[model samples]
Target: MRVLIVEDHEELAHTVAAGLRREGMAVDVALDGHTGLERASVNDYDVVVLDRDLPGLHGDEVCGRLAAGDRPARVLMLTAAGTIDDRVSGLGIGADDYLPKPFAFAELVARIRALARRTRPALPPVLVHGGLRLDPSTRVATRDGHRLMLSPKEFAVLELLLSARGAVVSAEQLLERGWDEFADPFTQTVKVTVSRLRRKLGDPPLIETVPQAGYRI
Candidate 1:
């Protein structure tokens, strides 16, 4: 899933971003509300981890703006205040969920995943197409019941393609959703990863390249 974390605490923001990345999630960080708003506006994010207290725009305003827009991201509001009023206000402003500060990392991950799931059409717990089956929650991929060993990148790529449900996914879309912000768009990383992933899936060549139009399952 792709997430945007809007927090002013530099260390905390980067730390959270790193953890999410290690969990095979695409993450982008904004140290202030304006940058966060700008980033969220341009990108298609499954969830926005927004800090309620922010500089240069206030988190409330940012949340309101996003909530009013069409196809806005699922907002998970974060605040130091743990009061019921605070959470209610956050939710009132269109945050889909609320997380108080000093929260457990595991809970945060779980909530993010839960929110991400709501952003798209509900799919079966195990994504199945032809002979391939991917259990996202367990991080397992099996082809004809044979477990496939895949790198994090390869796994992310495959998961995305399977989630696409045979729809074509552009290289740009793959890079944005599967890779971090630092990925060089001009580089051949997407192509390279797709090639490697295809070899592992083997057999019927399920991933089809559409000439200059990117790829589809």
Candidate 2:
């Protein structure tokens, strides 16, 4: 999943972003609330990790603005203030879930996943197109009942394609969702990952290239 992290704490934000990246999720960080709001306005993210106490805009205002905006993504409010009133107020402003600070990384990951699942259109956890089956939670891909091992990047690319199913996914879209903003489009990284995934899948070319467009499953 693609996520935006809005936190002023540099070290904590970096640690959370790194951990999420290791879990096969694309992440972007904003050090202050103003930048975070700006980033959220333009980017299409599946989830946003927002801090309640912010510099320019308080986390509640941020959530309210996002709710009122053209595109509203799932918000998981994070705060050092762990109180019943705080949680209620955060949710009242439009947060999907409220997570307190000093949380376990595992719990954070689980909550993010839950928030994504809740916001996404109802669909089976096991996504399938043709002979391929992908479990997003487990990061596992299987073809004809046989499990296929994939590197982290490979798994991410495959997940993007499979989630879109028959719809074409542009290289830009893949880059936005499967990789961080720093990824270079001209590096052929997506292509290399796709090639590796194809080799492991061993099928009648489940992925189809959309000439001048991108790739589709």
Taking all chains together, the TM-score of candidate 2 against the true structure is 0.92
Please list all clashing residue pairs in model 1, or write none if there are none.
none
**Cα misplacement distance, residue 123 of candidate 1 (Å):** 3.4
How many angstroms is residue 178 displaced in model 2 relative to the true structure, after the best TM-score fit? 0.7
Question: Each model's C-alpha lDDT?
Answer: 0.88, 0.85
Screening candidate 2 with a backbone cut-off below 3 angstroms (N, C-alpha, C), the clashing residue pairs are none
- Model 2 accuracy (lDDT, Cα): 0.85
Cα lDDT tens digits for candidate 1, 1-217: 7889999999999999998887778899999999998998888888899999998899999999999987548999999999999999999999999999999998899888778767457656678898899876667899999999998889889988888888889999999888867889898999999999999999889899998788989
Per model, state how many residue pairs clash.
0, 0
* After superposition, candidate 2 runs with Cα above 4 Å error: none
Candidate 2 per-residue C-alpha lDDT over 1-217 given as tens digits, one digit per residue, 9 for 90 to 100: 7899999999999999999998999999999888988998878888999998988777888889987887647899999999999899889988989999889999999888777766446556778876778887777888988988888888888888877757899888888788877888787888888888888878577888899999998
Predicted candidate 2: what Cα RMSD to the true structure?
1.7
* lDDT assessment of candidate 1: 0.88
